[model samples]
Target: MRLTIERGALLKALGHVQNVVERRNTIPILSNVLIEAHDGSVTFAATDLDIEIIDGAEADVERAGAITVPAHLLYEIVRKLPDGAQVRLDLSSDDPRVTVTAGRGRFNLPVLAAGDFPAMSSGTFDTRFSLERSALARLIDRTRFAISTEETRYYLNGVYLHSATGDSGLALRAVATDGHRLALADHPQPEGTTPVSGVIIPRKTVQELRRLLEDAGEEVEIAVSEAKIQFSFGRTTLTSKLIDGTFPDYTRVIPKGNSRVMTVRNDEFSRAVDRVATMAAERSRSIKLTVGDSKVVLAVNSPETGAATEEVEADYKSETIEIGFNAKYLLDISSQIGTGEARFEFADAASPTLVRDGNDPNALFVLMPLRV
Candidate 1:
């Protein structure tokens, strides 16, 4: 394989695919990226058995062939090259080395045969849909923070994506929960698409999909099946296996009878939580919230450390209520409220609290109170 590609173009393409290759791999080919030079373009593909990314960039191809080389090494070489410099790559089957030349610098990287790379099988997709990039971005951003990091409850380790009847008729919903808290967001279902089956998109793939959609154009194409999911946009494609566990029924967790409503400035509440949390113990990090008529107090106490209290103006008119929660969870859900104001509904000190942006039907969060 021989090709001449702009340093910026090559670096950008490598940036998309190389991260999928693990630094330490038991299989030799899994650590390398398959580079193919074809008619007027070059493609880079890398996979870690579960997830695969393929990126194509325009290049001047001198010879049509393919080679697999160290993904990180090639990325570093192109990244360090002077801006606007042209990079040339040459590799032949006889010599198991790839020659990379930019300006006056040269480097030879060991290569593996492209035929050794494992192919990812993306089975037939039962649901296909396309939506605005911003819509999906909002859904991911609103719920991804709530994904559980625990491996034992593998079902909670990813964002649950499915179709639901939301405030806006049929909607595409994403929900994630870590037992302690939950986040749910929805977008209007796109036209000309079949309803999507409930699937758990693993955290890693959710992260990669977020990165891929960073500077994406107007729309993104998605294909989903029981076992796999694929995202295609521009000149790149990402295929990932869906987590094979069933997500718990999240609807039952959301409280519908929490009538006591409290509204507060989003930034003010977040800042108060952060300040009071400093005095909390590293283990619990529990903060207590006291809601009184038109006022809210946030306080935290740790035996090893001191105590902190902050008073924030709120619009609470119900009976006095006291609730304890992890400061991190409060801040996370509050930060997702794009509106300046956030509304919280409480059933009692022990029942889960419901939170949402004032009058925004697109997203909601629930936090299970802690005993202080």
Candidate 2:
């Protein structure tokens, strides 16, 4: 195997694939990236069984061949090289050692036979759709924080993504909840359906895809199958196995008939919660919301940690009511509100309250109250 690839290009390809390699592996080949030099391009493929990523870049191909080498070490070598240096790699012998050379620095790293590398099954997706990278990023960032870490409910470990018929017809919706809090984010358009059922996008895929979507504004081609899903952008394609479980009916848990409404500036409300909650005990740091005719007060009190309260000028016209909620949960939900203002609709301290960003009547978020 022989190829000369630019130092920067090789490093960028390795950067995306290296993360899929496990730090500790029972199968040594699993720690290595399969490097294939064919035609006029080179490709790097790495996998952890559950997820696999393939990245291809243009390179000067001399002798077409393939080999497996330590992913992290190769990444480090190319990353440290001077800019514009050509990275020359060659493997000419049966018992191969990859020779890497760049200017004054050169090294030979032991290689594994490419035959031992694991292969990921290409999923047969029944339904496939395309979406803007920005749209997917927004959907993930808004709801991922609520994905449950509980092992017992294996289904909740990933975000539930599906097409729902909302007030404005079909919409792409994503939801996550760890019991204490829930996040629901959706986009009004760019939604379709197929025979294959909804799939739970694992947490790791969510994070990796987010990193990839950062520099992309183009539409991402997504293909989904019964057992796996694929996301393709530019020269990279990520394939991941779907978690096997059924997500609970989240909509049924959302409360209705919450008529008491309060409106406040998003930034001001978040700051007030942070300030008051600082003095509350860690075990039960619940913030009590007191609503009146035209004002709202946030109070947090812990006999051991002392008490703090801050008031925000709000637009409210409901019976004076007090409701308690986990301060941290409130802060998380508030942070994702994209608008300058947030609306909270409350029935009482015992009912779940709906929160929405600004006056977007299409999207609604519900949070179950806590006992302070």
Model 1 regions lying over 4 Å from their true place: none
- Model 1, total clashes: 0
lDDT of candidate 1 at residue 200, scale 0 to 100:
95
Q: Candidate 1 at 214: error in angstroms?
A: 1.1
- By TM-score, the best candidate is 1
lDDT of 1 at 133: 92
What's the residue-level lDDT of 32 in candidate 2?
A: 96
Worst 10 residues of 2 by lDDT: 188-197
> Tens digits of per-residue lDDT for model 2 on 1-372?
889999989988999889888899998999999999999999999998888999889999999999999999999889999999999998987646999989889889989989999889794777787888878888898888888888888889888888777777777888888876777876765645453357898888888778878655488988888788899988899999988999888888677777888989989889898999898789877889888977889897788988788888999987899889888888888888854789998887888888888845555667879887
Superposition-based RMSD of candidate 1 using all C-alpha atoms, in angstroms: 0.9
- RMSD values for the candidates in order, in angstroms, are 0.9, 1.9
Model 2 TM-score? 0.94
The backbone clash count of each candidate, in order, is 0, 1
TM-scores for candidates 1 onward, in order: 0.98, 0.94
